[model samples]
Target: MLPRLNLRTSFQLAYRARFGWLATGSLVALLSTALLSAQFSGRQPATVALDTGLSVLRLLLSLVLVLMTQELLSREFDRRYFLNTLSYPHPRHSLLLGRFAAVAILTLGLLLLLAVALALLAWLIGQGYAQATPVALGSQYLVTIAFIGVDLLLLTAVASLLAVVASTPSFVLLGTFGFMLVARSFGAIVELLTRNTAVVTDAENYRSGIGLLGYLLPDLGALDVRMIALYGRMELLPADWPWLLLSCLVYTVGLLAMAVWALQRKHFA
Candidate 1:
């Protein structure tokens, strides 16, 4: 029988499979340090070292989660292993759905673990820790996770689509990275453009509009919410949540549609 991946099963498999390997090793290592430091008393160590350590860990793992999603399609396509997936009785759409769902769940679990670890580390920081209301903390972390998810989903779409066209994982990774690195610099370009335009037009008027245009070129940096999450400024706006959710859904599904079309046309040698 084909796997019925609604919400629950998809999430469960994610945690059991990928999430554990990616997050657990790192978490455990950090936790071990925290435990060993229990007796040594110095606020600076936990505040600077522990807090920043866990934060960086979470960020890296989040990136890994996204990269892994891209590779899911890349590897199978590279090795001519799509046959195994096809043999299962599940359609390609269902398989893609399962892969996305599994990755989402893994990402989510890592988010939860990140929250708990950060929360504990913050509590231990004494004066360095800012007091946050429950709602504020929730909003901050939720946005962080959402930001990561949106970025990864977009990248996954690009990766899958690239594989469909390029037909090699190494080629796909290099091309995608090149395209993405160029796109990332657009924020600074937008800033420079804003400054120059202000002198010419007497306004920063369309600066944000230009920035919005950055969305088309793959704005993965936007998904990183650490600065906001830690600083307590950019909480998930009411509109932000729905926009990201909608964007991820549209991008992923649209790319997969393109992938399916490519696969149908592809002549496997």
Candidate 2:
């Protein structure tokens, strides 16, 4: 049992890869902004524009997390770089946490860059078409961005946790993507199964199954504040903010704990 851990070394290893990933994120942001500028809508161009830009940024951020997780964990371990790092005095948990922190920092930084770019584009578009459009951005938009950051952090932890159990980079990437899809949709699936009795088959059983999944998966739906931001519904934000943050923390910690457990048991030989 290793008692001492070197977080700095692990973080150094993780941070070294940030430049490439950040460039990829920036390119995606640029393309998303360009698409927003080119969109044509007969009604509510502002809403459409905001939605399209956000959707693109969200997808791009997701991709960044997936790729980042693969690069930082799966590939490094596959190539024995991570094992070499572990050869140092660092405990498995410390290495996992340090790498997680590095990835979280990178994701948060990219989120900030993307948010600023989106805001700048929104502002410019509003100014360019103020009279012809209803583009209104406020601090509330920042609130949405903050929640999106939380969502990405949660995803980073999820991907990190999955990578520990996954054998190959491809498996980690695909598994992470699939888990993201399910976690993001878990709430909606539950609602649909419970509310739409006509479409749902064996409603009770389906609900039970989904409920079990919900218990196991993080409720990402709670972090979705885009609609509130889009409609400027600041009043509705308060009720969920505290709970959402708490849930995000709980889920992130849980995932990291699992990753640490997996790493402790993982044999480099």
Candidate 3:
């Protein structure tokens, strides 16, 4: 475990790929500034511009996290490099955690760098920007990144689990993408089910089934409370924070356990 932690920590600091993502998201800040000028007539257009840019950055970065995670941990190992790790005395859990940690770090760093770029843009644009305070804005951005990290930890754990269990890289990639779609669309799904009666059959049973799924699936969208992070309090109510943090931790551990079990009997074709 300690070795895995060390491995994860070391890999997390290596930002080569992550920096490229940061550069990409920075482009959103540039385009968003122009968009905001046309869309926002408010006195706080600067705030609107920054938030819009951050939103775009957050979205693209999330997708980047999923793609990069699948490529880094799943695709390579699925292609057989996993044998290198298997040859060692290392525990499977360590490998799982190490993989998750590396991806989470990459995601967090990309978001942070994008946040910095957006803040700098706000500073340089001065009229509407005069109201924009970089320190406060940066803190808000950090909080959003923190929120992304919590779920990124859980999601990567699950994705790695899928990879361990899957027969091929294609299967792992498809499964991860499917899970991401479900996790992200659950809200709209529930809303659609509630509003339209034809989509689901056996109303009572359907509701019960979806309810069960809701309890099982992670509430990833809850982490996108960007406005809450940007302009409101970062502190969660004592009761709330612990439950949320625990859910993520438990989900992460559960997925890791599943991954280890699957890998135990795994054999390449």
Candidate 4:
């Protein structure tokens, strides 16, 4: 239907405009970082390489998601190119959802490519050295990558929502990253405050305030499973996976719903 066609067109446009260079640059950066980290770290080279690669991959994917949102959504609106599409008989929410779907697919595709490259690089790095704690290249690594994808999709949902509500493309990029920083850091901040009550006199009040913010924001930090991939520590993952998956799903769907509602009411002049 219209959603399918819109998805195809949006994806094709994004592929042609951004995907090629972005993918190439991202792969190069990921592999280069892994190699350098492996070279520099005498002990546990593979673990360091994998850890650095995952961090770099997360950053690169976030940049890709934000840039794609800016180009595909905000820029289209800014240049009035979206007007022609909005004039179609299809519902506004369909168009918005279709475009968001394109972003999701493209981001996931990039994540997969970079993840494969990182895994290969990690394996190659491990082959030369036998460390005390070997890197987990099997299911654990795959699970880590899957969770990272979930995190990026959540970010994409944030971008999609901001794209609809914000006035400028810059705001969409800024707002998305800002939301990410807060979501990722708030949990750690609360935990640090909880552990070191002496660090702040009003720790209880501060914890309560941050706890309030936690309810509004997705706990992105909870989704980080790099340690499991790097060290094969599965002690906490079994109990945490279901809750993490559910929280991500709920937040993503809720954000997309809000985006659709906003797009439906948008007065595109």
Residue 196 alpha-carbon offset, candidate 4, angstroms: 1.7
lDDT of 1: 0.58
> Which residue pairs does candidate 1 place in steric collision?
none
Best-matching candidate per TM-score: 4
Taken over the whole model, the C-alpha lDDT of each candidate is 0.58, 0.74, 0.63, 0.89
Task: State the lDDT of candidate 3 residue by residue for 1-269, as single tens digits.
Answer: 66656465436534434646555655665566535662563555555666676667655665666666666667556567667655677666666667667777666776666666776665555343445432245566666667767766777776778767766666665776677667767755676677786886876567666667678787666566566444545553233655776777888888888888886766665
Give candidate 4's error at residue 139 in angstroms: 0.6
Q: What is the C-alpha RMSD of each candidate to the true structure, in Å?
A: 6.1, 3.4, 4.9, 1.3
lDDT of 4: 0.89
lDDT of 2: 0.74
Question: Estimated TM-score per prediction?
Answer: 0.64, 0.85, 0.71, 0.96
What value does the lDDT take at residue 126 in candidate 3? 39
Residue-wise lDDT of candidate 1 within 131-240, one digit each (tens)? 33211345665666566656655655665567667856666667656655655466666767766875545346556766775666654544555555544566433346
lDDT of 1 at 35: 49
Question: Of the candidates shown, which would achieve the greatest lDDT relative to the real structure?
Answer: 4
TM-score of structure candidate 3: 0.71
Give one digit per residue, the lDDT tens place, for model 4 in 87-159.
Answer: 7898888878888889999999989999988999888888899999999989898889899999999999999
